[model samples]
Target: MAKPPPQPPQEPPQGGFGAPQDPRSGSTDGPSGYGYPPKQPSGQPGYGYPQPQGHAPQTPPPPGAAPGYGYPGPPQPGYGYPGRQPYGQQPYGQQPYGMYPQGTYPGGIPPQGGRSNQRMMIVISAAVAVVLVIAGGVWFANSNDGGKDDVAGTSGGSRGSEDGGGTDPTEGGGERPADADAKAVLQVPYPSSVPVDSMLVPGQWATAKTYAKPSVYSITGYHADTGKKAWKLPLDGQVCASSRHVTADGRTAVVFQERKMSSDSSSEPCNQIAVIDLDAGRKLWQKKLPGDRVYSTGLSLTISGNTVASAWIGGSAGYSITGKELWKSASYRGCRPRGYGGGKALVAVTDCGSGIDNEYKVQKIDPATGRAKWSFAAPKGLKNVNVISTDPVVVAVGAGSVSTTDIMSLDDKGKLRARLSLERPEHGQPKYDPNCRIDTESCVTVAVDKDNLYLPSEEHQGKSQYGDTNEIIAFDLGTGKPKWKSDAGEKRTILPLRMDGDTLIAYRQPTLDSGGQVVGIETGSGKQTVYLRLPNETSESERRLAPGYGTGALYVNGRLFMSRDSIRKNSTYDKELALAFGS
Candidate 1:
């Protein structure tokens, strides 16, 4: 409900496709017109299952209807996937001006309030334990410019006992020091000559032994504990789409182009899919989809069990991890599978029809056979569906004109349990926006566990006029009510990465003086624990990097990994390919 304290101007992001775009400032620069190609009458829902017999006739939503506004009524024919029917179309398209934009928060933290004395004591102990865990290896140096713009080795450098490179001179590639733990910090420099049109560098994965990410046309693994290059797997062309899911053994899938992109030519097709083992650093198998079809440059690739599924504008197909063809589903009945969400279960989101006739369906899919286990049809006129989680089954939906207005939680069957309103938070409450992308599973700022959904409150002005702050709120999945909320403390903001057991692992954005931190919030109690305190020395660098667009942040095995989603050619500023921090 308040604006952040005023701070120094942040440099605009270096130009490139999928470059980080922080939404806290309300900046609207992005791919034009919803970031998807226009669909024709015969066109696909850029991205289904079956059930029920003919029942009641459907009533189309009124013109200018928006979710949580004038729109009302349960999904027609109830919730199950519709069998082929002659249900007519309804004209719809009204934007909710209250919905927040997609992306990360780039605002100052707020002053502490609203917590009991007991909770304050718990946070204090956790902070002390974090410092003790890192021991003598880390320090928070003083900053003259409020910690903004100071490089690690410059005159205002905030690091202690460090060189300009952000690494010890004697600590070349070798065994990680026993002292290196979650508090350790390292950075990888950006590759030179990356083309602006290359479009994407889209995956981030971690193993106990290595931290791996795509750098332009190659995938490289770095020693997890020490910042040493372990292995690099070069590709024939730049990576286009990648699965955020990884197999237990550290293997993942990526789709790349057949030939290197040329600056003189239009973008190349992303037609080749490959499975790479991150720990061992080798491609297990690579194959091209059958037929040319001029596949959409942005294909949705995901892994569920041993099968890797891909969907695009033309159609959808499945493949084994060993590269065996499983099954393929072509468009049928004016509906096309657009993308997939993979994990504990495989799920697919399909778009059917065009314009007011357009409808989106979320289906629980069979990983191996390409059959629909069950399907849930979203209300007509809500054009986009982003699967936030597969197991408990949470989805964020919005109308054609906005990013997201509500979140729907469903049961194991295709029935909807509750719909959480994002467009209409309680009065005085900060507006909620997950900033979900067009893909099925690309809502990066939101996370869900079995019983509750977690999202960050939009940053607002703090009690002080000097800065802004926010909190993470959890909602009960069954009733769609607020369960608890946790603050990120003064001058800091936090985003949920994922679940580490019952604890919610979150990253506290760096401030002008303090480096970013890794925090664990107990789900039931809403208690906060500071697990890792990064070096104040590199706070400026850490502040410059926040997860948004194709870029991301991950915490696993006590290490924090961040990567720029893409790189641009002829940039005025230097940007790192990726940065890793650990104890």
Candidate 2:
């Protein structure tokens, strides 16, 4: 075929796509223009343009576009006629396909140099949606009402009030005002008669005193703030014993001689618990037990609310203070039971035997109804066991080839929630030489205050020899985590632990001396205050001293009770000390 004649180059439409066409041009401006098509350049085709000879075939238009839309021209092809009107304007009343109606594009189509306007619109819509979601979340969080209900459900809820509520002080079911006739009264009773061996003023109570001649024993009493005898309970008979117990409200006094009996094998059997009403000189109540069981002098007598409990041994049958019989297992042969923290609950351990075969059984008892709560068989190799506390939970220490500790947590219904083993250093070579013939297997003393437990350990040589070298370690009762450890030295042994406000007063015995000493220590700060030596001097025939923070006084009945003889020896020479507190 003959080559087509060369044509002149054509100009692109003046207006871009989407722009209005000018009436003066008499035709649409863009690629879709109507009427005569523009001419092509030399070596290119005109109007309905065709490809040059040997040129590659061009791509077709999109499905909806005209046949030549998007088609690439030949290398030397000239610009073609404006294909159609720019996309913006259309025949009047004949809307452009796919274009939004007029006034829809308030700012018109966005600049098209980079991304398509449609893509930019989608991006902006997504960003606005994300911002709205964030704002909604923030508002919901700030307006939360859950915390208010939480506070209202707490113990302190009643103290809260709504705004504008009148200050009648009776809103929200608050307590009513006291009656006109209501009077503030002291629960404790005042002392009356004074004992002959009285030492200090009536405000002080006498814990214990020994007799030198005739019948050998001690007679102690509780005194009142007015220097009067509240109650006088004698620690007499051949098997005399006393325990330092505090009332639920923290009244300090000796719970002595729940029952008394003669040590002589020929004496009549007695089985009564003599509960001394310390503040009133009257007996609270004496509950008869099975036999003449007696408690050691230093054991803790626990009192919670109005119930008092202790571990006693004497009768053929072993029983708790609530009159419940204890299980007679082989594991509880030589061991004596002791109680901790008050409640209707108690923990006790009984010896199994000696050596590898040795074992102990720990029992939980309900004090209120005299019922058995739970029982656990300790490891077979344990040589000794001690019950620490039962309020927060029940914890016991077992000693054997390896010193292992076990803790048990109980719910209010006496159900075991968790059984945990406390961590301790593995048994290794003895810290002290093997030749050091000391009592290593002695029973460990365990005490608990609030949520912390204090365990007994040997004192090191770093501190004074007279101090308790073996020390007390504190552990979190709830989690069994260690809190702190205290080393007073080797000589000091924790006896009766008392608290005056936040101060901890431990009745300790110095190793250098045989008797006990009252050491005042701060609970929170772990600081020591007074270290008053107990009246245990050998040379002094008779002496009496008052210790502790408050009124340091010692009284018997309404009079001061003096110590007439040292606790050690009560030979024939000290006759006057015999009549001190009355045999």
Candidate 3:
């Protein structure tokens, strides 16, 4: 038969986390590529053991014979013996003691081919045994040392010394001393089992728990200064998703929930919104959505005194928090819906049509009354548009061939004051387009501070190189121009951009190798402080995963609550389904 063609080499997923696929072979169900072998059965002979079926007879050695001295007594008939001895000569082919001829056997064994095969075999075995012993010793040493080198390094205020040396106080540490004006804040502990999401009010203490018996999730407010649960209220159905929006005075908090089918069948969706008063834990009101609606992709309830505007996207409509119909529109065929920022004005975006040509429509609406403040068709080439912030300025991002990002300052009348455009390079050069062949363009995700905007770009290279790279660029809000660009060195899916006083807290889903690290980037100097780093041993599949943020506390309230999976093991569908429904 003709030889089969050689198979092409498989490529591992770049930067790691994704589906639980193989690293080397890209196989999801095959053996792990981490170099450890599968478990072996007990009592099975291993390595160099001889098979039992082979035919061989062994003659016992004489007393005091060394371990590998071979057979004693005399050689049997038909076996080669030295000196061509006749039968019965010197007692059955055995050489006479002290009369054995010189050169009869060199090195304690007759030559097989000018060299003693037996001696050669002994030497080879000894060498192999020595090598194995050394290798095992090295492995044992590393195991005892915990497999990491404690190299002398520096972090924060002090020099980090290795196990072998004392830290030098004169060397400048890699990290600056903690700001004397800043206080070391301790994060308050919530229920260890609760799936706490993003914080709505930072530095303030709040407690939330999912009550399975009543199929409702409740949020209890606590004074950040006092650490006491002030009030608790339950929403209407079991909450699959929820968020907390605080009133301007920071005294009142509105806990919003979307009704969904029981955990038994998550596919059965409902269109209802429930609101609870944070101070009294009372059900303020509940509104039935006007048609069969899927749960909202994004929900926000912002209050300006008595005027509260709740923004949600679902049921093919966008509505205010009071269950008042704001604007009814057709649902985007394949894209997820989003609603953001509701003060005097509201901004919403939805997929316009189907196919790859689909575009997003961004509209501004009056919050007091469901009135269209202004509407603008984002550039047709753009795929997604989102409002970054409402106060100071209103910035919206539009992704396109080279992501035409526009930052607009909207006046109270919804009139555009100043507009700034940011264009990402399609290729290293103007004419060479890498995404053209792949039929995909790069996307720019926006992160906003008070007067600075951070735009993260996802650039695609060809197959032979790193497929995607992340870059963050800072744009000045006043001039609407570029400030400084910083490369994140890894592809990261950014979460909500948060401001902790003057510090900006940004969460990113980093590429696989680094695990997921939440970083606090100083918006002033663009320096980053790692707030949290997950354990490195986490599987690549789970490490690349993102979690949903629900009602939680932020930094201002003296606590930060984040939800992430702590453990995952393979299981059957029946087992997983049962666990998901708490059965």
Candidate 4:
């Protein structure tokens, strides 16, 4: 792929965790390994699961073993509550993302090349997942230094968490918006949602982890119907795509991002986190992930109730949204972080010299202190059982192979109560798209309620454009019994985004030619109740028939929120969003 055409640098305000560190330019004035503590093992010992009988002796797959390299095979979804669309924020100390080489798509759009999917996600919990949109492509790592730095606004570790003061502004009192169709909403400025001009470039949004850049990053609250920017709050780092949320209370938000720092000409990559108390319209606290156990802080940045937790290479740690360190621990040999149960339980994988041959135990720890309380060991063959959910006790699941997986629900005391099996896509199929479950053989896209668990079926295999069925299979959580299969088997298949109450919110494939509808399906039985056909641009790109650059539709309360962020087909990401809301 050719590099993007160079244009004169537009000097903008310097924003984010600090200054930009594009290693490609040979400027190494940033932090790389500073402030990081040495790795230490957890205090617990000899934690093992009873091996299952009659199964091939398991061992972690050898290097270069399987054709796939994503989140530990099938069944492992990017961490967090099963349906939160999160990527593990375990900060496993993976090398920093590479620079975007100079390249431009002939059509001004990146060519839809064959990029390999996110083959392996080594981390704990859910907070920052790469939404791998698997279309055809080679898995290449590169970034674009399309920005020039200038000092702007005030931020970085230098800013006090309480800088916003007691005078709050955005929406501090836990109140919803007055407009019936609009809920609490926020829009962060540029670089927050960078465009992958060419499809060949890995689709991971550069916005998720940009260090200091040319523009001051910001979050602006907007009036629902008028498209007015109500208020703007500045921050020092880019927001992680997987960990951005506008809560129901309308008063708070959690922003996750990666940062690089330098001391004495040596640089280190670190996780920059902040709690944006919307009411104050300023940050409550802004700090680097703390504690010796919190290595790789960005790996699993999850917010469960009042607590926020991070899993990393050194270990996993929990914190209060106010920036208080609640607990931390060092994970022993081969043990990996899983998910947080919000004051209920914290789960992690244990005993894996090699993930396969070993009988992996899934241990539940005290949410406050990282102390091992109980463990549910996997039966033989079901290696490396990763805990996925805590809302309803513990749902530990693992991929037996690329095509098969095992899902088991364990009781509070670590007793295996039920198990189920599901099918998944092969190594290089389109479903491997990060958007399709972060480029894994399978995605942990199951939606569970008090009584049932809903899982979307793989996009119908084979030729597109006809007879393709996109489905959500519902199963009883207690008995692991199949309930019903709801599908959108129409001309243009719809994508099931998430579960809202007893209904499923789905968006029809957007096209340049016509408007699209946000369809609401009944979870009990696959029935379409609400079909709101939106404006043409609600899902379409300004220049082509394809879906807009960062297009996605979510159903909130009585309104449908559609966001389209693109710089190619359109001049700016914000305009696309405002245009989509054209009333």
For each candidate, the alpha-carbon lDDT, in order, equals: 0.56, 0.28, 0.31, 0.34
Give the root-mean-square deviation of each candidate in angstroms.
21.4, 43.4, 30.4, 19.6
Q: Where is model 4 poorest over a 10-residue stretch in terms of lDDT?
A: 97-106
| Model 2 lDDT tens row, 359-461 | 4445554443323355444434332344434444454433222122334444444333333333222322111110100011111133445555444333233
3 against 4, candidate with superior TM-score: 4
TM-score of each predicted structure versus truth: 0.68, 0.39, 0.42, 0.53
TM-score of 4: 0.53
Model 2: CA > 4 A from native: 1-218, 222-270, 285-287, 291-304, 308-345, 348-364, 381-384, 401-446, 463-472, 478-481, 485-583
Write down the lDDT that model 3 would get: 0.31
Best by lDDT: 1
Model 2 is weakest, by summed lDDT over 10 consecutive residues, at 132-141
Model 4 / residue 492 / CA error / Å: 3.0
Could you tell which candidate, 1 or 3, scores higher by lDDT? Answer: 1
User: Tens digits of per-residue lDDT for model 4 on 1-583?
Assistant: 8533222113211111122233455442432211111111111121111111111101122234331112211113243222211111112211111000111000111111011112122223222222212223221111212121211111122211210111111112212224323222233232333332211111111111111111223455445444344456664533332222233333233333343212211112234656654433566786665433221111344444455555543455555556776665544445444333322234544443342234445555444444455655454433223434554544433332111233556555665555554422222111211121111111223445556655544444324443333555555666565666554445344555445556665555533344555566666666664355555433323212222122333343333444332222122322323222222
